[model samples]
Target: MPRIKSPALLVAESGADREGHGLRRSMGLFQLICFGVGAIVGTGIFVGLSDSVAQAGPAVVVSFVLAAITCVFTAFAFAELGGAIPVSGSSYSFAYAGLGETTAFLVGWCLLLEYGVSVSAVAVGWSQYVNELLDSLLGVQLPAALSASPGDGGAVNLPAVLVIAMAAALLVRGVRESARATAAMAVLKLAILVAFCAIGLSAFRDGNLMPFAPAGIAGIGAGTTAAFFSYIGFDAITTAGEEARNPRRDIPVAILVCIGVVTVLYCAVALAAIGAIGGDAVGGQPAALSYVVDEVTGSGVGGGIVAFGAVVAIASVVLAVMYGQSRILMSMSRDGLIPGVFEKVSPRTATPVAGTLIIAVVFAVPAAFSSLDAVVNLCTIGTLAVMAAVNVAVIALRRREPELPRTFRVPLYPVLPLLGVGCCLYLMYETGWTTWLQFAAFLAAGLLVYLGYGRRRSRLARVTPDADATDAVPQPV
Candidate 1:
């Protein structure tokens, strides 16, 4: 039989290994919630509203609801597993404890696309908001050649590269500092968004909401696919299992709270955007909310405020998600499935300094030159697949380790997890076929890496090629 990490071992290794390196346990419930909000509520609400609106019209609000529903199911599963098997690596760790090495590797692969590629895409969108803010407040804008990526008809997205660099520097300083930065920015962005919603709803026109769901069921499905991207960061809360002060309780509570908070905010913003300007006006825009604010107030000042908020919001995502990605790599490296440099925590910073810098440089190239659309779909697809694996891990663990202690359990046992899997698959199908092809390519690449390098180097591989729960390469707790 293939090796599967026991839940007991997963818990036992929650502190530092004999080597004296481990993630600092500094995050409280508030910081965990801040990380969740910071990871989410960024590029999606600030920039993606236009694409979703074009697909579902005023029904984009419905799209947000449906997407949130799907996330709720998966979030339940994540809360259950995170509490029971609290560890870094989130879904990848869950899979290792429940499904075995190959599955865990694949989940980690999906996460690479989810976090790594996503940072690049979000950074690209951040450049657009930067240009918007400059034009509104400074009466000057970077030439497209500097602000836009080569794939977007420019030489390089310099702003995107700049944001990634800033985030990388902050992350290398320490997770505590990262969480503080995320929390402060999260508060600012939330307040700005709330203010925008109030201002927009005040001028709401009943006629703008007419002809909702103009594209019907198909449109809603497509729109839901895009809206799911907004919810991507909530799972990142689970990735903080090792660093969180009380992972058993805080992880589940933070997961649920984060999802609820984000859902309400998304629905409010979607409604506000649709009501303030008709779907036609909101569709195909770069910075929809800021544009609406500028239009409603009849001045650039209102837009400038919203744009400034967006600049902060998008920067928070880069910081938080980049943190999540580094932790994921650190966990993988601890398993001997990747290079050891990732797992090497800097004693001064207690962070993955070397790995974070490498990750930044690798993905920064995409942010600097690739098209935003090119990365977005691949990221969404990867996220859906990783989420589905998490749902499966929940079921697998329940059956494999019936005695495992759980601080929280999914409300309906296997039913909700099953639904979570279904929702993830349905959303994947709703996306364009090109995304499927890209995801397939990524999966193939991961398989090659695992078979060629990870399979031979894994600690489990050397432990007689069978179950070695007590002595396999344990993750960085």
Candidate 2:
């Protein structure tokens, strides 16, 4: 039997009518915004907040703002590329079009770690919250063997695995269905967060903020780096460029609006959490939100609600991240940078079913057994690297293709992109050397894939898109 090659290596003109690629152009600005929100407001807010507050005390609120500013810089660059290219691959396609094959492969490589592992990490976090909610609401709980990962002294996380599998099923069914599910969950999560803020604020103590810079400026910087992970999903808006109804106008709007919404939410949530619990308690205490709520409300109800909200929120994150990974794989497959099978679309559902399933399996395993913090750190590094690359791509495209039609352009050319690169690099450094080592290992794997298959097979390696060509119309649904 002949070995079946991966679909990611197939080179073909991508369009809605293409046999293997079935992503539809049915998403509009609202759906796009929902995607961003679903992806952005997950484990970072629910789980990572405790760590950030611990690192920076009440000053984590300021860290959230700083992280948002960093994201804004890259968001501008992404909006420009996403609008101009309007493709399914997100940063991967943009880098291919503007940079080159090697760089494109690297971008895809970075995204694999960023989205794949991030989904796993979010699923793991979801498991904890689900267990918390069950214990609180039903007076029952998943056994330790089923609720925690192996490293965390458990056999497997059944809840995490279940969530990943369910999300995969939804994605394999169709993008629209998945988006609807995500949007519903996002709404619930936001509502719960707002409720927490309103209630928690009533219990705020000014003294909780006395040692605002407990970790000092260094701690604040570290907090910002950690908090930056919370902002990763803001770029999910750009991932839907090809699906978006009006990429040029809506992608930018969605990105900006999502960032603004999430930033404000992060600040409010941090302020409330810190004010109610104090920075020391939030940082040192596990399941800080629940503890804070129990302390203030004089009942378990607040904690139960937040835990339930977290479960729902991280479910959406897992779905969105997996969705993004599959799409990127589809794009790579179409470009002949990976095996052709990954590009195969389900005739009935019109989705990259093979790719989606493959990634689902990959993510599910880790989600079942890995630690959330380890996965989160890994994702943060990959995301920061990609953001930095996008910043450079922005400058490169501007200088290289001065005449290309752009629906959205990053203002303050060079300056904003440069700042974006600088900020991402600073965060990358703050991610610590251990995470960097893991990132380096991931990058090495990507290099092996590129050298082994991607370099020789890449469509761009054979025929680069003409710099002046305007004939490549956006794919229709």
Best lDDT among the predictions, by candidate number: 1
lDDT of 1 at 160: 95
lDDT, candidates in the order shown: 0.87, 0.80
Question: Worst lDDT window (10 residues) for model 2?
Answer: 1-10
TM-scores across all candidates? 0.96, 0.93
Q: Which lDDT tens digits does candidate 1 get at residues 1-477?
A: 777877666556545222343678899999998889999989999999899999999999899999999999999999998888777778888888878989899999999888988898899989999999999978999999998876678998999999999999999999999999999999999999999999899879989998999999999999999888888888888888888888889999988998898889988888888899889999998899988987888888989999999999999999989888888888888888998999898989989899999999988998998876766888898899988988998888888777677889999888899999999999998877988998899999999999999988887666557664734444333
Q: Residues 71-131, candidate 2: write the lDDT tens digits.
A: 9999999989777666678888777655666777888998877887778878888887887
The local lDDT score (0 to 100) that residue 243 gets in candidate 1 is 86
Q: What's the lDDT for candidate 1?
A: 0.87
